[model samples]
Target: QSEDDVKTHKGEDQSEDHIGACRGENNFERIPVAVSCAEKPYKCSECSYSSKSSSYMKLHLLTHSDNRPYKCSECSYSCKSSGNLNKHMSTHSDEKPYKCSECNYTCKWPGVLKKHEVIHSFDKPYECYVCNYKCKTSSCLKTHIRIHTGERPFKCSECNFSCVTSGNLKIHLRSHTGEKPYKCSECNYSARTSGELTRHKVTHSLDRPYKCSECNYSCKLARDLNCHLRIHTGEKPYKCRECNYCCTQSGHLIRHMRMHTGEKPFKCVECNFSTSQSGDLKRHMKIHTGEKPYKCSECDYSCIKAGTLLRHMKTHWRKAKLI
Candidate 1:
């Protein structure tokens, strides 16, 4: 009787082990085949779409919806991912953690710093298939592609100005708004843009980097040299559509156009007197304010305009008071 009881317990243990092994095999077969096959290519668990590269999957996730989970504390900036938001925060802090391996150029963002390093290394992996043009950045190559297509995606809302990039359109909008955000720390003068402010600062430094090929005349600003070159070339780029009046400078052309249109934008702030030109209005305002900006180099004589001072200097050249 004891031997029969021991034999029955052993038989039950063997049956349990066989059932457990079968259950394990069934679970292994029930596992999703797509998940196992997707091990080679990354698949977004949230969406079933699989991508060959992980970076493409990340970029594709942004297109699903307006999922801007990352927020910036310094400004009203947001991004779809935490990594992008972290990169943007560096701009506000002015912290450049990324340094170029080849040069002294540093950038707040790693992507920009990598692009700068390519310049020193002269590594242009991105190339145009249509042309001989090549660029270190894929973004730059995409922009160059627009040159072949003649695509001007950015357009000014205020005017007919159009550009290939949104950045150029932003600069063009300053002309309409006259918004000068760039100011000189040394002086009270400001400019519409940083580039203009930089050029204005060069005047204070008296750094005449641009020189004329024809004469010894030099100017700190490139625009001044371009205008000076016009003198040698006699190239009149500005022309009056109303009349045959032509001028080298756009301001002079604008003033000439006023003669035909009888349009005077400048008016005296004190009196109701107005003039067609700003210089005329400035001279007229001196009558009310009694401000003389021009001084005679010869004598203590002062005048409102340089032309008036020049006329006053003529008296010194002539004999004493006329009989």
Candidate 2:
């Protein structure tokens, strides 16, 4: 057949086999007539990748190999393809083409934009088996399940500390490293996590939205207000397994459990003095520094702790027959 006849066939059948036949007489002989006339004939054996173009198939094959020809100029990021390298370059820039219509959220990638869009939707497919808690993503549901299971998969190598999430574990590691990446804008206060910095920032603001009905107690967060309410109600929800001791806060329960387990996690760097509570360790350090922060108003006497100063004031009250 003439070249004009092949062009007519190309315009009629846009199949890969028809395109192969139009290439050369040898190409027409190589491709079998019985072969499937699929648009994406070039398939990768390594993965479920298939492409209509041979160049796209070759690029897909590079993903299966260790060869990274594309390198970023701004960073040490290297990718197997130019397309992926172009995506990596966005991290160096403030440009976000994909934006959410529902919110002020903007992302560099379309996949991330799609993920953010799910938050606007009322559909929460992922639900917890143990609780009524529901989330948009399966990963969120998996993290929420840890609360019921008491499973702490993320563990620290420096200490026996373990947390429900890897993000919490990462923040815990910063405590050992003394790395405070998040800083408060209002003060010189710094924290290991952004959440901690956010909470600290609230202290600078005079606006206390959460208030107690029982008393004049007020806080920045609803969780803090809930905790403060326990003081008026005398609700000790957190209980000890070994003893009848209970506390209103989970941290208090954790410290109380240490007494039964004989676990003194907080230790002094200057000496061999150790304690279960961090406040106890701080008070113990004062013995080394000879720092008496608590002072008596009635006398020239000063003490390391406020409790000691209070006891000392009681002696003057007894002298005046005030008791």
Candidate 3:
């Protein structure tokens, strides 16, 4: 055979060897012949992809089949390769074998550790096609794409609740489960959501971090500060659909909607008396409990409502005017 006809196992040129003689006095070892491209030794019945090696064809066949021979003994998790099954087995144990060299990051799976390494690089390969938005991970890019596509793929199986991202859907699922993962140590107040817990914890703190530049008003939440800033700006984003009424916040718009709908959610325990607002229901409770919280500063006059106290103060003012 010609030198060009035969090649090494590493696909190196056999140009150094002669046709039928050795380079020196010692006989040359016969290198493995190059596999013929015309006749592919291995062919996958599942797909059109054919290869010279039987191992490559077998691996390709696994992609088509749902048959996961390699499975975890602890769990129902099944994978095509033994490597994936070994990775899945780590979930059953507290073994985080793979560790990141750059940081203190460690994970059970190598793939997870690889993803963590991307954070240290500070290179965001994924970019949104719709805008100039870029993020570190592909998952973040997928979530950002929903902004343009309006695709809320993740949905709650329990209810009609759906969100643009999986994280939002996970938070929404807590409402159905009644799961309050976050708890306040200061007060025994448990909240279903993290934001609720965060806001609740702020009541314990003396300092109000979110301060309004326009006025002396301060709050715990940035969202509340944003809403407060609208008071100075007079920027009412929410408007009543039924009427010409407008509001700065969405909560006000929701309450205004109840006015048009005639849907009274808050009800008195003593009577069938119901009101759209919770504050109105609390005021209605004073009628049953006879709780006169509002008091006049001038006289021993007290009333259930603040409006009644203002009217009672006028009587003291009228006497002073006559004097």
Candidate 4:
């Protein structure tokens, strides 16, 4: 063959090799191949694909399968391929492999680090085709689109509740079951949701992470902080239709409605007695069970009812001369 023809044949072979590599063949060793920046690329063997570097070829392969062969030596972390492993190593090295052109914040992974820098740059690259809402990531934009479409794919088998995402559905399930798997070791408090448990745990740690933007009142959770902010703003959005009673929380409004409707949802199996609230039913149950769950922290005084315990605490205060 002619020399030029031979070179053309070699280029074709390289193109085929790249395509095979992209299709998930571990053909190339870690050896680097140098090519001129201006040279036209060749197509892949298995598909119509071309890449400037062999590393790009390997990354493209990971998209086809769920294989994570590369692992982190420092931790039990693994990735679908070697390129991801290289990215994961940067985290342990404290290396900012990815940088934002607009901001100074650096990240270990190029994708995540790129996202962080977008906040400082105010760059909304991913725009929702349905709405004007813009997001930094395509995934966020896709999720937002569901709101417009009213597409709730995630559904709770136990209830009629449906959510746009699986994560939201999982959170909704806690409300029905009242299954609080997470508990605080320091306190008797527990919560059905992890977010609530996390907030409860913060109370033990004395970590008021949520600070009011308007005032000095801080709370362990963002919801508590929001409610506290309403106190400063004098915002009572929840109003009772039956009475002139106004509340800051929707839950308070719901309980107030029960008083007007004479609706006792909580009932005792042992007796025909019913109460408007679950807490009231629980306190009443103590009359039958003779369980004194509430006790005075100061003295040996204890009572089945929390109100009685409060009155008992006052007696202790009176004895201590504090009140």
Score each candidate by Cα lDDT.
0.67, 0.74, 0.69, 0.65
lDDT of 1 by residue, 81-129 (tens): 8777876566445356788876676766676667666666578898877
lDDT of 4 by residue, 62-178 (tens): 555567678777666666866657754664453456777776756556667655665675678987664345678777777666654546678766744455677677567666656
lDDT at residue 232 of model 2 (Cα atoms): 90
Per-residue lDDT tens digits of candidate 2, residues 186-277? Answer: 77887776568779888788899999999898889878998999889887755565667767775676666667667776778798888888
> What stretches of model 2 exceed 4 Å from their correct place?
1-153, 213-216, 229-248
Residue 216 lDDT in model 3? 92
Local error of candidate 4 at residue 2 (angstroms): 55
Q: After superposition, how far is residue 213 of candidate 1 from its true place, in Å?
A: 1.2
Per-prediction TM-score to the true structure, in the order listed: 0.43, 0.54, 0.44, 0.40
Candidate 3 TM-score over all chains jointly: 0.44
Task: Kindly list the per-residue Cα lDDT of model 3 for residues 1-323, writing each as its tens digit.
Answer: 65655544345564544422321212222323455667664555555676665556556667777687996676455669887677556645556789999988677777778877887877888886645556798887876665445456777777544557776876776666665555677877877555687788888888888998888999888898988898898877555545677777646766777766676756666888988887998899988989999988887888998899998899889999999
Q: What is the C-alpha RMSD of each candidate to the true structure, in Å?
A: 15.8, 10.9, 15.7, 13.0
* Alpha-carbon deviation at 172 in model 2, angstroms: 2.4
Error of 1 at 197 (Å): 2.1
Candidate 1 segments whose C-alpha is farther than 4 A from its true place: 1-180, 186-188, 192-196, 295-301, 320-323
